[model samples]
Target: MAQRDYAMSGADARRAVETGLAAAEWYHTDIPRKEMKALMARADQPAIRDTGLLFGCMALFAGLGIALWPSWGSAPFWLAYGVLYGSAMDSRWHECGHGTAFRTRWMNDWLYQIASFCMVRNPVQWRWSHARHHTDTIIVGRDPEIQAMRPPALGRIALNFLGLLDAWQGWTKMLRNAAGRLDPDEADYVPEHEAPRLIRVARIWVAIYAATIALALATSSLLPLMVIGLPRLYGAWHHVMTGLLQHAGLADNVTDHRLNTRTVYMNPVSRFIYWNMNYHIEHHMFPMVPFHALPRLHDRIRADLPAPSPSILAAYREVLPILWRQLRNEEHFLTRALPPTARPYRAELHRHAPGVPAE
Candidate 1:
């Protein structure tokens, strides 16, 4: 295949539509209506409990960090706080934005707002952005959210662990939005009507960050920022680790999620912090399912799915080589084998997957 064009308004965008890949109907595993209905059912209790735990830990850790500041003794507490703030909030922003975390709309909206702020994402822009992500996942030139674009920027991915590159981009985008201009890529997916709201939120975020920086300057200490902004940098590792595995090294421009996603079993703590998103395939297939119900959903649907990686490390073992290979081939990607119980991939679409090697 020609070198991939990942830009939404580029030649590949036209090619994606011409090839019938953009907004194409995707394959889904079969499930009984009753069972699927139950799986999709929403509730408040689980999200309420999880949100409480998430923020509760943040409070406890931040409290201890503050109480023991200016000492190495406080480092662990701040580290823990950073993961919760930096990593945990990413999942919270995702689930709440999907409106699957809570049955109550207001609760989802409230948490989405808070989590979006923590993520340095514009709630209005990201809501639309994520909607487009679901609509055209991994379709090169169509999916604005494809993380590991062809000839992936290996260095940028490395810097993301420290939130440096992403923070710079995020801050720049926030400022641009605050100045009432949507970046070209952002405008491709974000609605013009929503621009005002996104701009307003960006202004609000600028005010908050400015105040936090002023407080840091006034006190001549990094403590204020530790509570407000620095965690997004220092504590971003876990989320970056989990988030990359969602589609990294997997097939792009394919309709079958089986070819494009991974589901890795993770430790309870990582699963909790990542909100069970390690069930990546299932989440993509059933975006309406609440995070609490994902394990059950996985059990219900696993027979038709490819086997999940036994652990996060196992997934890394599987993904790292593919990514390394892709750096050389650019078009190289992993092709997951579905179990015999699974329905065959949609033949017409799978037959034409660009750059995918023959099985």
Candidate 2:
């Protein structure tokens, strides 16, 4: 189907359900390696420049300046780090996830491991989970990254602690996946060849962490390990907040492709800094396109998308009505968007539950 045609029928909630369910069954029951290979290849393009790197570095420098400059010492360095330096780091990792950090694949992996180590994130776990997110956007029981539960204790524990814990949990998840504890279908994005590299990169990350701590203890009087080191955790929290706010509660229910992700209004500055990731829907549809190309793709397809929720601000407001509900109970947010053909549809009854109404 044309991307445009996909967008139209895709706007109907029921159409989304049918389409996603069908695709999931096909992909899961009889994996179409050839077709998938072809599909993924079609979207593959050369690595693009990361314009965000300079800005990210600047943000990091600015935050550090605020923290260390004598006159600026009490300037709430963590806040500056969170809103600015943190998102800057996110942009870096975001590009790394796409394998766009450098020309060689190995080079890119190393860059991500080093940069991610400094940022206190695990590139291997992030790459795996993020790739899975692309493969299964918003498909409940499928997308491990999707905000699956309400009262978000899981998200809170996993995501809130400056992504250190989130990254840590991701590593733990990766270990289980490697051990064959997780279903192959649910394994997300690990590949046989990538395993060795991930293990090595993980070891490098451990060494970097230890060296950083040891250096902090030996060199600085202020316990640089605790003070400066904690900023990366602050950065992780910023990542979690912005990331969750961007996509968490947009849909009435999880379905697939179109309804699962939403676009937000972004100012030019943000567009430049965030590298156009705010065009969430288009990126989901065209996952292989690098961050730099997203704006062009979005422009080409703008008229085809469901009208954007009035503005990013308005869109955020729209999610609020459901946020507390989601926080109160998972069921409230666990519904799926339905396909047009399936309307006259009843709320999806959980196969596991009998005589129970869908929330």
Model 1 agreement with the true structure over 243-288: per-residue lDDT tens digits: 9999998888788788788899999999999999999999999998
Model 2, 34-68: lDDT tens digits are: 54343334222333334344446556755575457
Candidate No. with top lDDT: 1
Candidate 2's displacement at residue 56, Å, is 7.5
The number of residue pairs in model 2 that clash at the backbone is: 11
For model 2 the local lDDT of residue 132 reads: 56
How accurate locally is residue 342 in candidate 1, as Cα lDDT from 0 to 100?
A: 87
RMSD of each: 1.3, 9.4
